[model samples]
Every structure is written in structure tokens, then in C-alpha cells.
Target: MKIFQSTTHYNYDWEHVSTANWQKYSPWNEKTPHVIAVDTLSRHVDPASGVLRTERLITCEQNCPKWLTAILGGDSKSQVYECSYVDPKSKTLTLCSHNMTYADLLSVRETVVYTPSAHNPESNTQFTQTAKITAFCGGWQKIKNKIEQFTVDRFVENAAKGREGFEMVLERAREVFAQERERMEMSQRA
Candidate 1:
């Protein structure tokens, strides 16, 4: 079995970013190693509780994880993630997730937190992502340490590719945020 944990961080607009729905920062990209498509299986926002629940199939268009290909037996490029997030009133949006498709193939989970800097709220928004992936492989417990290290090396490589994609997402989000602000201002003037 192979397993790993990784963290990533980025900055955005503190105020406008918090005002947007999480959809503003889409994870899909046409680039390598990024999700080829985001199939929204289900989505809902509870008006009473101000909670958003989203179920999506994140399909990776590129090559599958080598570990998954070697040990697992099915077409394993896509994974389902169930997410629960709250309103961003506090300039924070935290998402806790579960990988539904990982029932027997591999286990995956992530906690993504978005927060505005307390000291620089007007200018900066911080995004922190903490994620883990554990592949279920038979035997080789004695070599578990080596397996883990190798998986971590692979994970870091994949994460770098993902980061490049997300940076593109971030820049697009910034453009959307600016457009929203311009529209709002124009409406107020009208």
C-alpha cells in the first residue's frame, strides 16, 4: 500500500473572494494531470443552515496514478468527492470531503480552508489545502516505509501539476471578481 499527505497555499482578494460561491474557483482544467471534467452529480445549498453540499466526479483526463494502475484492477481515472461547506460570512470557507469512489481501490480525503488574513483582510485571502491519499495494496508491510516514501514523491509531483492548474483557476477567479465588482458599481450608479 502507498499513502501520503500534502499541503498547498495561495492568496487572493480578501473581500470579493469571500463574497463568491465556491464555484468561482473551479478545479477543472485542460492542462495535464488536472481534472478533465467536473461532473456535478448533485448540489444544494440549504437556506436555513447556509450549508452547501456538492457531489462531483473529478475525472482526470491524463494518465492514472501509477500505483492505482499497478495494484488496482479497474478503469480508475475518476473519483467521486462528497463535500460539505458553510457560508463565507467570516471570510472563511472550509470544506471537509470524502472520496466515495475509493471504497476498495484507494482512500482519499481533503480539508480545504479559505480565509482572509486578519492583518490584511482588505488585500489578502489565504487558501490552504490539506489532503491525504492511501492506496490499498496487498502485502509488503516490511517495505511500507519505502512504499510511503515513493508514493510521497509521486504525490508531490502530481501536486505540482495541480498547483499549476489551480493558479490558472485563481487568476480566472480574480477576473470574475473584478467583473462582479464593476457590475455592482454600475448598477448602483444606474
Candidate 2:
């Protein structure tokens, strides 16, 4: 009787295992393994003091509850940072925030409408509409610039009122103008 010997082979590279595994486990990979897109600005949690704090973008969809809705104000659907805070004791939630740009401020206009009908076919349909105006940051930089220009113009006009020579008034105006500009700049930087 003739017997044939069987061979089993296993491919294992112990030396290169670490390098090969690194890419599979790397956190910086371009594609997230399991990611669900969520509106970051729509998550909120209540504090101990009964006040609601709108959570920042760091909180991802995985951590937040699925019931939250993302509503961006105005005609455009661009998302901004904000959330509706629902109180356990009450049916309403108060909105709050700061540091708004001009575009941000303009987005506060919102309109909502609801329509309900009755069983009677000939009756007119009932409708409800509500409008709200929210406060937003008014692009403080632009306002500050306008104020500074007005201040300088007023100073120059006042200084020229009773001046003897054009050059002397101009020199004094420059000195005052420089001082005012420095003060404003310092305040802004602070």
C-alpha cells in the first residue's frame, strides 16, 4: 500500500503585522468607518439651574439623541449654531446666544404656518400663521468703524472752526487723530 503525505501551510508575517495593522486602525483615515451626518447646532442639554446650554459642534450625532431637529432660519437652508431647549416642567424653550455677524443677524426672520380642515366640504379652511424676529450679532466691526470715522470727522470740523492758519490746524488735527485711532485700535485688540 502506498500512502501520500499531506502538507498544511499558514501564511504569517509577524515582523510586518504592526505596519499593516496601523493603516487599518489609524484615526486620521480619510473616510470614517461609520459616520452619520447631523446638524451639530441642534443639540441641547439642560443644566442643573434649569437653564439650557446650546452644545457646540464638538458633540457628534452618535452622542446626541435622535429626536432633535435642525432648523435654520430665513429663506436659505445654511446651518448655524443653535438649538431649541425644551423644559421638562414647561412646554416652551427659550433661545439665547451672542457674537453675531451681519449675515447672522439677517437670518433671524422666520415664518411658520399651519392649515387645518373640517369635515364640511363647503366650509372655508382654517389657517394659523406665526412670525418671529430673533436677535443676532450685528457685525460689531462695521459699526465700530463707522463710529470711529464719525468721531474723527467731528474732531476735524471742530478744530478748524477758529484756526488762524491752515497748516497749524492740520498739524493739530493729525496729532489728535493719531491719538484717537490708537485708543480705538487698543480697545478692539483687548
lDDT of each: 0.60, 0.32
> What's every prediction's RMSD, in angstroms?
3.9, 33.9
Query: Which digits, one per residue and each the tens of the lDDT, describe model 1 over residues 64-146?
Result: 67776666655656554656464645556776665665456456666767677665666666666666666565675546555
Best by lDDT: 1
Sliding window of 10 residues with minimal summed lDDT for model 2: 1-10
User: Which candidate number would show the highest TM-score if scored against the true structure?
Assistant: 1
On a 0 to 1 TM-score scale, where does candidate 1 land against the true structure?
A: 0.70
What value of lDDT does candidate 2 attain over all alpha carbons?
A: 0.32
Residue ranges of candidate 1 with Cα displaced over 4 Å: 1-9, 14-33, 65-71, 98-105, 180-190
Report the lDDT of model 1 for residue 127.
Answer: 65
Query: How well does candidate 1 score on lDDT at residue 183?
Result: 100
Q: What is the TM-score of each candidate against the true structure?
A: 0.70, 0.21
